[model samples]
Target: MEKDWPSGFPGINWLGRQEEEAVADVVRKGALFRYYGPQSPTHVDQLEEYARTFYDVDHALAVNSGTGALFTAMSALGVGPGTEVIVPALLWVATVTAVIQNNAIPVLCEVDRSFNMDPEDLEKKITPRTKLIAVVHMAGTPCDMDAIMRIANKHNIPVLEDCAQCNGGSFRKRKVGTFGKVGMYSLQINKNVTAGEGGLLVTNDEKLYTRLVAAHDLGVPWKKGLPDETGEVCFWGQGRRMGELAGAVANIQLRKLSHVIAHMKASKQRIKDMLGHMEGVSFRRLNDPDGDTGPFLILMFDKESHAGGVAQHLTNGGIDNVFHLSNYGLHIYHNIRSLVEKVPLSPAGNPWSLSQNSDSLFEYGKGTCPTSDDLFERSVIVTIPSRLTDEQELEMTQAIKNAIVANVTS
Candidate 1:
């Protein structure tokens, strides 16, 4: 470790001693699996209940990973072969994979500063095959749910809120995931609520919850040791149950989520405010539920001015910044031209809209997302969300501004 870290270096200590103690107890007793015993609350079960109460949903389901939760939710929503789900083009690979893994075609939509799916773009892409609109609350900034919901409802499509990065974010006084039929949050080590590797799915619909539970638990629809208020249990969802240690650790971290989120927001704002209004840089927009902003700060660079190359300059100067790209943007299809060619649609509609033919443009293709294509080449990620003092945030902001504005002439 460096003698001194950059103030908020360690993000959130999502796993505390309480979690270790619980896990230790479980390990000591060798109850690593669910269905360990009756009258017992395995780490996973309590975590599910905590998620329900925290998100204010009727029920919660715990799983092995965020991807797992997404897959389960997609299955529960009946999104499968020949179906389509609207997903944003500026999120983690897991978001797109969840749709494709469910055997549904992921209709990639563009994102605005909020980094959430653009409702207008989403509506433009909806079709008879569109069964669910999966909105990823990117970088903890909420999506425009009012518009998203309006379009979704009008199209008769159930919304699946992918809140993997917005662990504690909300929309209009309600949790981010609560607004949709199903919501999923990640608990990876880098997440605001780290548990090494874990995920949770929440919903107000009993039937949906039952299905997710079965999906995560390997399609075994019966409740293990938890006391079922009703004797009858469904016969579905299997192998999605979280590990005992992950569950135990999550419980410890759950109590501190609110506090941790508050600190993260304060830190996040500092980075945003510092870079906001800076020449040739754009900050993400805030439209969804305002909770603890997630762990990372997303910045868009000006592609016309060679933003990607500028970002490379910052990296060369010992300042680290990351570019955000969707799975389809990076893995499924590396270039926008190929993706559009394969999709058989106007390139104007895809998330790669910024891929203009301009010589200065970030080379994706013509008519890609004006901002995204530019940002992909020039964007910067400050730091993974970490708790820090004022001085540290100031240093980061000042450094970013200096590098981005370096030799930039009007």
Candidate 2:
């Protein structure tokens, strides 16, 4: 018999009142468009205002997707042809997408135990063409800010944090997005704050804020009170505005994020501590976590030299929550277009390659990022995360140990 885990859905709230009225509210009034005017009841404007305040940023632009925020920000920042944006190969596809979307080259860099950018690798990758660095805090883990910032300052490269997976997470007491020049958030259904489908960009620089706002709002400052005529507008932009409904849901969810994050941290630590005791398997330790308590725990299976088992063992031991591909669960990368571009060597030296990348920073195949590749092959990519209770955590611990004892070979 299969064990029924209550949280099969990505972001189902058993005790959320804010989201309780979410569905009904959208269905009743149904003001879908965000640009209705001063009287407009759409929550998108309110959401943007609320996000700006909550995130402590000068401005927050809401958009259709978190990737959209990255794309829009890159465009406004002038990251296009001939520009190089540093990125992590181990991160989500969107991080690279933002760089390529702007027609900029993406120089793949390595990650430290914190799962953030490696400042050493970053230093080596920067060049005259380098314009930006899009760093993702893997699994809501904060990156080494002091190092990343120092490097960015040294090279004058603007950091665009792909914080889609880390909404309420922080770095050295400051919020993740605020640490960089601009930060992007995802409100996709599976994220901490779910609005079905949406994203937000945060910034403190007034000039960048103005540019992004104008670009996001049809090339004008056409928020709630602007006329639909050229007489009131001064420029042109594509319509990437998010509806009020998304903003409404995000507002209420934002309030509960801290509590949820706290719970997740507690839960993640429990797993980490338990897994750390295993002989062949160990949790990746880094300085950024303050030694413990983050949104999730990352355990790795040591290489063939040592005895270890990957997350596949979790399935045999009756535990099933890992992320090899998808952000939510056991999903894989399945973009069909990538097949045609297969190359034999990545600039970093991965033997497998793409025929043609959006930019040159991406190589054919040099078989680089071996650590990520090895871990990807043998890891479990656990996703039980910060939501499970102590009892549930214990059960998972037992299952993992049992799986490892039976599976790890000499």
Candidate 3:
């Protein structure tokens, strides 16, 4: 008789005595605020230093959220009303909203089967008014940074990478966050590294780093430059700093990230190998399989009907397999009404009229990106826990195969 699988996989836990001690230390010292540092090594400062070194970037600034990181990056890069920020058609809602938050128009570009920005389409979307190119490494898979960077370089446009879901992902052996002018990472509950709710923005350019830090910290530089008559220094900024307690937790989590990613990758690949040869089933091909963080086990079916059947079978087998599209609710760009309308509601379009390069050059509604639409319709995503024991992996793969066999007709 087969062993009964646990009710649910045990979620990843780098948090333990270390995290408890870190939080306790913060509470005891009442240094919950990042900037309340009279001590030599503050939590926030240490986190920033570690993050910068981890990604091998020159600077890293912790913020309140991933959205805050993106918005601050755009603002620092001078994205404002009437500017066009090239973004992949398929990405998290935060990616689009961050562009809008800067009062810039998001020029949604197409994505290919890789589920990343189509470099070809990205090139086509570029024009004189294009201010920046923001690329999301969707599902912990790195976008084709080589192609994207080539395209951006040809047009002399800067790039901002949305690495929220790609903490340990990479391209060509280089970490994902280092591919662009600036990169943002999320430390939310679901992310690879969690600080409850926080974000980190990293960059190699000194000037950009200074601007990003200033923008996120209410325009005040870490090292004071100038002060007004009353001895007050003023800079254009907002309160986007991460709390010291979160910072401390994040620091502990960061240390364990590599190990977490390694286990995830191993488990994901094992599952992929087990399920690859199943009839009518396909897997998302990684551009750099070695660089993948392996947080998800995504499968695709040759036909939409086949995918539907597999989804139903998985449900019947007591496994939760999500069909990326046709789900009651999705956050993809096509479903977002606010992104495809006119005036206050359609900020992207509204800015077109005011844009200096406007020839009324944007259209949004159903079928904006046919490729992205079809990509999701034929795919199923299964979440991969940070750690999966051999027995659990075997049970999971067996369940998947059982589901497919039960559903396949022919």
Candidate 4:
């Protein structure tokens, strides 16, 4: 039964002729670069246009990858040595790495039971130097944006929503990315929608949009199909433009996103219903269940040993990508060696040692976020593949039940 279970590559599972056709069109037209080529390139431009409508934002920018979007956004937001950026403990290493890359200190905010940023801890983490709040919508669930935005507004700080995992998710009735000043999404192969590798950024700020455009390209916004060096937003750019090849696929994939999310959400709901309730077994508390994108299901246990046992049992049963949250690799802060050790970017021993960052002293380790550390130790994360047949779902449900019975109930 386990052999029949699908691996959790969400968008890859749904790829077909549509993606192939889009790619073929780019090759046929001989327009590999997004800006210019033998034929006029429009795929990346079209993807951004469609993204604006889909995410309901005024501006959208396509980039090379999700990490590029983060770096570009942080740069446009004026993150530097003197500033601090608040981030949830349960985020991809790229989230925190963006802060460090920008020469800003990342203040770790504890995550509540939602497994997303804790709004209460977020407020406490804010300081006079706090320049941004990077809210990560993790594991297919939207964060508490209402509470997070209120805190950010009170402090007059900007929020950058990282929707890499929860691409189609919303909080309350609003989309996750719209709540922040700038929001970014990943189009990596494992994401809800794939371009194989691409990223999208959305924002309502016109002035900031110009900066984003410049920062993502050659440090100058494009004017009349050429770089406008005279623009006020000029600076050093990261050359993170999305190629036409990726844009072609991403354009079609963006259109299919809602359908992909709908299928995964329904499948997850059905599996959760089948599991029902069990003693000493619980699910992660969603801030808004209606808005969940549903790529992963998290089960909580009373003790770390129980979580470890269940994860091992499920893996032994041939379940793919099951893990005790503590062992979830770079997604957990303590596991990020570069961040935990304050590894400097250069021999200057800067960022941490610079005069501008001297006041923003902090430590990172297992004890830094005790609450999140506890949650990590006692939770089991299971990947919910994008497409699952009735039989596969049944097998998964039964396998989960058996694992819990063997580990928790005993």
TM-score of each: 0.83, 0.84, 0.90, 0.98
Q: Rank the candidates by TM-score, best first.
A: 4, 3, 2, 1
Shift of residue 322 alpha carbon in model 2, Å: 1.8
For each of the candidates, give the backbone clash count.
31, 28, 0, 0
lDDT of 3 by residue, 1-410 (tens): 13453322212355678888888888888777765443435787888888888899888889989988988888889987768888887788788887777767788888887788999999888878799999999887889889999998888999999998888788998999898899999988888878888899999998888788778876756664232224233357877888888888888888778887888889888988877687677788787887888877777777777667777766666665344453514347767776776346353444555655364367666688878778777877776666667977887788778767766645
Ranking by lDDT: 4, 3, 1, 2
Best by lDDT: 4
Model 4 alpha-carbon drift over 4 Å, by segment: 2-4
lDDT of 4 by residue, 1-410 (tens): 55655659888877889889888998998888866656664889999999999999999999999999999999999999999999999999999999999999999999999999999999999999999999999999999998998999998999999999999898897888999899999999889998989999999999999999999998999876788878877688999999998998899888888898999999999999999999998999999998999999999999999999999999998888999999999999999999989998999785888899999989888899999999999999999888899989888999999999999998
- State each model's CA lDDT, in order: 0.67, 0.65, 0.77, 0.93
Candidate with maximal TM-score: 4
Q: Tell me the lDDT of candidate 3.
A: 0.77
lDDT, residue 146, model 2? 83
Tens-digit lDDT track of model 1 for 375-410: 444555555436556776776677666667673433
Model 1 C-alpha lDDT versus the unseen true structure: 0.67
Greater TM-score among 2 and 3 belongs to 3
Candidate 1 vs 2: which has more TM-score: 2
The better-scoring model by lDDT among 2 and 4 is 4
